[model samples]
Target: MNKNTFLGITGLISCFFFSGIALLQAQSKSADLKNWPKGSSPKEIGTRVADHFVVTPHTNFGKPTPPKVITYPESCTWYGALTFAKASGNKKLTRDLAERFEPLFGVESKMIPVPDHVDYCVFGAVPLELYLQTNDKKYLDLGISIAEKQWGPPEGPRVKEESHEFYKQGYTWQTRLWIDDMYMITALQAQAFRATGNQKYIDRAAKEMVFYLDQLQKPNGLFYHAPDVPFYWGRGDGWMAAGMTELLSSMPKNNPNRERIMKGYTDMMASLLKYQGKNGMWNQLIDDPEAWAETSATGMFTFAMITGVKKGWLDKEIYGKAARNGWLGLVSYINENSEVTEVCEGTNKKNDRQYYLDRKRNTGDLHGQAPILWCATALLR
Candidate 1:
């Protein structure tokens, strides 16, 4: 062959070889994507969550609470499921789960009727969001009715009585507002306001949030789980952390309370950092290291801190390491099936370290999974 022809043939062969290698690498990456770090993408993490925990039929709807048997944990589960459904494109699960709550509205009497609690807020709020997403007026109406009944007038009590064991002796007479209440209902209220053009929902949300802030903030910038409580609970903090992100996400950019909410979030995060475990997890009792490292709260905190960074409310350089560590620690506890272990079970906690450490860890529950999803979503973003 001539010299020019020989050179041209060699270049073509090299190009073809390189292209083949690139194609192989691309296929390998796609096949191994699931093995990527847990924080890779919201869709992936969400898919893992759905695949592992969503095995049972209507696991989201637990035994109902008062006038109705349906409880808030179920609602929270459904919320997570709904988010997972949307993220994973599982339209059928989304539709089925959303419809299950319709019967909750049919209960003739209020079964566990303490309106100002986090349960009321979360239960009412998730359905409201689902309603908005589906444009289903039923969910919206049900959410509104529950909010109106449970959220007492700004000047009064949302619940008729603060008879719950946690509030039986607290000095406050008004409906007890916990940090989790913000997570439970604020976004729903915002949705209600937007859907109906009614200012009452927004006003009510702001009023209750202010009540929570006024009553729960400690001098150190961390908030106590409840007004009468002294110690900061990690999961409670998580609830508030997630709540702040969701509420702010839905809030109007120019809303007067926007800056205040952001400041509150910043302060909370700063205080939380002081207590973060060396392993990146927060102890059950956030302020105390003697307490055991808890995964659910850590997951929620990770979500909140990362989200705060994304929103420009927090410095990612300073907080990113902490969030990453928390996620790593959290991952150690996630089983192959996506079941999260070492999550503290439900507790109406007081400001006591012993109480936090003593709480049992439950697997495969929404409390753990929701925060895990939040953490994954935050990290992915």
Candidate 2:
């Protein structure tokens, strides 16, 4: 009886120890999120960005032809809008965004793009989010249908360099090792876990994140455009920064890879702090001093930093000013139309540095618009 009593008391002590740690962490995050600097507050910035998404029309996919279907950039922006609407307590905006999605469930069903690639797979996240917010099974069914296809064996022709064997190893058949895939793949999977309370989705994402960190992350904690394309492109790394943040946020504390992932995230955040431009932006080529200031990357980095500080991953005192400065600098790029500027246009991997430097800087691209809303939601959440 005494032995059993001692064991029971020890277990109780262990539980309290863990519970106390969790409480303190929660308190740390709550304090930082609530005490925002004047103009950089999430309430102010998030609302502006959310309203802008409401007013914006369907994107053209950056082409001259009309947009017949939605894509990742728009999907990301939509997900961001939903999160911001909920965080800001804007019921009208939430309903408005829901109404916007209503068409897809009815006559516009065909407009939902085929989730055959990484970009299309991300479309699932929005619907999953809709399900979470409204508790509607239609949204849940539609989203899981799309997300489940990600891990299935290849049903189509393989890309030139992609491996069909990845499915055997439990990775999505779409694995290409592109830095962008980090966000494209992990964001959807993380949402799946969030909606369903399943461990597999977050576990898979954490393993995938660690793999990407090992293979792509440079010594200084930035990634090259691709394995062969050696330049450290801005938005490319932004995808990683934001993706890591998303994965870390949803993963369980006991996840085997969590500590490694945390190390990688903090390392990258430290490096980002080193390269921040005078105006608090990261350059188009992150390591190139002459590269132009880019808004999308700046917004993404800010979002990651803000989230890190709130979650206690980063020291609040050190990252708070940097995050605030990034928010202020990023909004300065927005024009009267509420469009973000200096976004690097959609890029393909090329081994040439000049190719990246010469890529067009677009105004009002969804690539740029998506991250601002994410930053605001990060702040509000």
| Per-prediction TM-score to the true structure, in the order listed | 0.74, 0.88
Would you list the C-alpha lDDT of every candidate in the order shown? Answer: 0.66, 0.86
Summarize candidate 2's per-residue lDDT along 109-148 as a digit string, tens digits: 8879787788888989999999999999999988888778
Per-residue CA lDDT of model 1 for 250-319, tens digit only, reads: 5667777777777777788888888887566788888776788888888888878777776777776677
lDDT of 2: 0.86
Candidate whose lDDT is highest: 2
**Model 1 TM:** 0.74
The residue pairs found clashing in candidate 2 are none
